[model samples]
Target: MTTPQDPENRPPQQPYTPPQQPYTPAPPPLSDSELAGYGQQRPAVPEPKEVRLSFFLWLAGAILLVVSSALVLTQRDAALEEARRAPATPGITVEQLESTVTAILVFLVIIGVVLAALMVFFAMKARAGRNWARIALTVLGAAVFLYHLIGFSLVGLVIVLVVAAAVVTLYLPASKAYFDSVKRAG
Candidate 1:
């Protein structure tokens, strides 16, 4: 008794047919080299000559420090004699003066050797493209310059000049670029 307009009177329904999608290719997988876990190869940038030269200069400075310290110690006897000839302090005995002078010279020699070793180590690290190392070398160089400024001796003049030159070379345009590149690569 259902009418044609009723739900039970409607024609048999057809299954839905979805519209086809256009074909698109899948993206290729990442290559082994693209993986960060795999060690990334650093670019091969040749070291600038200036850096090499600066390293050599630092090495020379270190050697000079060691040799100069030894030489200064050898003159301790003369230094003591000069101290004796100079007017003695009111109550300080010659023996006491001698002991104090000897202690000071020995302390200076120990400082010299330690400074030399530090210079060489910093130079090596700087040459390997460590900017911090270069900066440290500069600070140490400034120290040497200041020390010489106070003493103002012939040997000190040479040492100061050498360190100054080495520091200068590190800041040259090519050397700066080299260090920058190395920094970026690592």
Candidate 2:
């Protein structure tokens, strides 16, 4: 009781201690199975490859039909002028040439427009995740293949075959199945 207090001898301050808090655990990351259930896999979505092929096919078809139609129209007037100068031609006539070309061009253009519309329709359906769109597009593409075979020579036929193959390949069963699942989900 007689000892004098010394600065150095003073009791060291208690070590700082934070107040206790409730223990909390972070939620675990989702597993692959959990993600699969939600259809988070990349392959679950419909691929756009087939849609692109369809669009290109429709565009080329439209251009060919339009150019052919224009050529027939431009040549029709010239043929008519020639026919007017001639007194008479028993079998051949400008009217016949014009009508024949016009008929052929109109038929080709109509077919082209129909196919193009179908292409756009299928593309939209595919984008909306319709499985049936795949089959429909495949059929249309096959039809295009046959049409091209009759309309085009060796080189053009080869090109059409390649495009058709690409479309059919891209819209395979796996992709269709994925789209079907997506359709069911919505």
Candidate 3:
């Protein structure tokens, strides 16, 4: 019964088929962190008192910047008066003097308020054990310290002292260990 093309075959060979396997669904991917090795949860670490104190100091610094700016603003009238009474340069007029001083005061107030907002942000992030934030704060604190050193004003002195304390607290042994733990966990 074989065809002429398979003259030696007694019957047509059966088609080949693979053995069946059980169905299994693949695992779904969860949220991934922007930072490397951040998605995996790690054992909890207790925060140290030094870190808390530093956080408060940062908040205080922010408040001080705002208060000092407001206080400086309060002296606007005196500053304007003094400018009016002072020996005048040949070209500047009283109207020009008042406007310029007022503008400068407004600009300074805006800067102070903005700086205070930034302080709060950095403080929260650093307190949460963000290594980058802490490092950034350190750099900023050093810059502030150096800037204040060049001036002898009361406001600058207070800000510098507060920043200096916060920076010191961040570098304390307990704070260092906390940051290290956070890094390891990340």
lDDT per residue for candidate 2 within 36-74, as digits (tens), equals 668543334555555455546544644553444344445
**lDDT-based ranking:** 1, 3, 2
Return the TM-score for each candidate structure: 0.71, 0.49, 0.70
Q: Ten consecutive residues with minimal summed lDDT in candidate 2?
A: 64-73
Candidate topping TM-score: 1
Tens digits of per-residue lDDT, candidate 3, 1-186, equal: 954665576577788989889998996765555355465343357668998899999899889878877876897998788878888889997788989989988887787677777778887888878878788788877765664454256987899799889988999999999989987876
Q: Residue 18 of model 3: what lDDT?
A: 90
Superposed Cα deviation of residue 15, candidate 3 (Å): 24
Which model, 1 or 2, shows the larger lDDT? 1
Model 1 spans with C-alpha error above 4 angstroms: 1-44, 85-87, 149-151
Superposed model 3: Cα runs more than 4 Å off = 1-43, 85-87, 142-156
Give all candidate RMSDs, comma-separated.
12.8, 15.5, 9.1
Per-candidate local distance difference test: 0.85, 0.60, 0.79
